[model samples]
Target: MKRCGVGSKNQAKLQAVASVFAEVDYDVQGFDVDSTVSAQPFSDEETKAGAISRAKAVLEKDVEIGIGLEGGVMQMNDGLYLCNWGAIADKQNHVFTAAGAKILLPEEIANGLHRGEELKTVMDLYTNRHGVSHEEGAVGIFTNGVISRADMFIHTVRLLYGQRCFYLS
Candidate 1:
């Protein structure tokens, strides 16, 4: 357990990381870093690179461990899916990353994404509210509260932590 620095003070990311380290007696601090937050053409590879880049920035801020959480929408042959990526960077220069569960977006939302709109913006417009990304998010909107943004990333954080706890041990 070490001091953890999160790239964004986003509620979901905070809860996701804190939930994992709750029993470990480690300090978790949240920050609002300036991140691209999305890929240029919208691909998982760029999404992952963004997460790693943000995590490295946080690590440079004197944190023992840095975490990054990025959410994006991916297009498939059949449809679009909401996707999330998470990365962990340690002082040792080791990095581990993972992604949350994805849910296909409704055609309406998919159309917006295809038009170059971000998922959060599209979700906000669809739900007729603001800041949904910081709250329940697309996953929540699709899953009907069965899963939350926080809950979704918690699983991803676990995946990242699993590697950290294993190889870094």
Candidate 2:
């Protein structure tokens, strides 16, 4: 099995990517790299950039692969939505990227964000729970546990791997 390192201290995100990697024969590991990522609230580009940033940062070592995940918000004609982004980097620094699922926020939650609260903070307060981002997350609550933050993140990682697989093949 190949070795994989994920650039995140958060267990949920790490496990999300790791679980996906397991299906592809990688021995997964997590690293808490300071990504210094910035989110533009509703910009998919910036959100994806954060994941790319972490993927590159995690390459400080000789791991066969590195993974990064980021959560972002985007506004649409219907409502605002939460988005997840993922990136995978190879030992030579080639990067592949993708995004996870998105959930439209209820009006009330959108209002709170308009009041200047971050998605993490707003979800915590609205759900009467803390660290929603770390656990199942907003997606979990929105889907009544049918889907979760990790699950959504896993989708992105899988997509990234799919793209990488193409080139290798």
Candidate 3:
């Protein structure tokens, strides 16, 4: 099986990729790598950059494919929304990127993020739970369990996978 490396050791991200790749023939593993961006990305561009950075950084582990996922809050005219991005990279320097759905965060959560707090921390404190990022995530919490963090990333990964397969083929 071809080796696939993921940029983050986060369980949510690993599971998202593994669940998808399980349908294929790739061996997926997670690695602790730097995103090379601020812990809290405030814009879609920054979030996308973080994903691409992680995807490329994890490729150095000698895997045939590398994947990266990032979660952040973005400010739009309506309000601050939770945003997720995913990227796939190959040894040939080909990169595929796709963004997940954006959900408008509660005013309190947006306020916290605007005040220089990370989404993980803000969500945990807002929900009075620890490790919210690893668990249901802001999407799950906001949607009242209708969607999960992994589910959102899984869709993004699927988009990346499809694009990669199409172009590489």
What are the lDDT scores of the predictions, listed in order?
0.84, 0.82, 0.91
Report the Cα lDDT for residue 84, model 2: 77
lDDT by residue for model 2 (1-169), tens: 7888888877788888778888778888888786565533456877888888788888886678888888888888998888878899887768998987788989998898877788888889998988988998888888999998888887788799889989777
Can you write out model 3's per-residue Cα lDDT over 1-169, one digit (the tens) per residue? 8899999988889889999997898899999999988999988999999999999999999799999999877889999988989999988999999999999998998888889999999888888889988878999998999999989999999999999989989
What's the candidate order when arranged by decreasing TM-score?
Answer: 3, 1, 2
Candidate 2 pairs with clashing backbones: none
Each prediction's total of clashing residue pairs, residues at least 3 apart in sequence or on different chains, is: 0, 0, 0
Q: Report the C-alpha lDDT of model 1 over 41-153, residue by residue, as the tens digit.
A: 27677778778877888987767889998887677888887877889998889999898787888999888888888777888999999999889988998999999999999
Clashing residue pairs in candidate 1, if any?
none
In Å, residue 72's CA in model 1 sits off its true spot by 0.9
What TM-score does prediction 2 earn?
A: 0.90
- What's model 2's overall lDDT? 0.82
Tell me, by lDDT, which candidate is best.
Answer: 3
lDDT of residue 4 for candidate 3: 92
Q: Which 10-residue window in model 1 sums to the lowest lDDT? A: 34-43
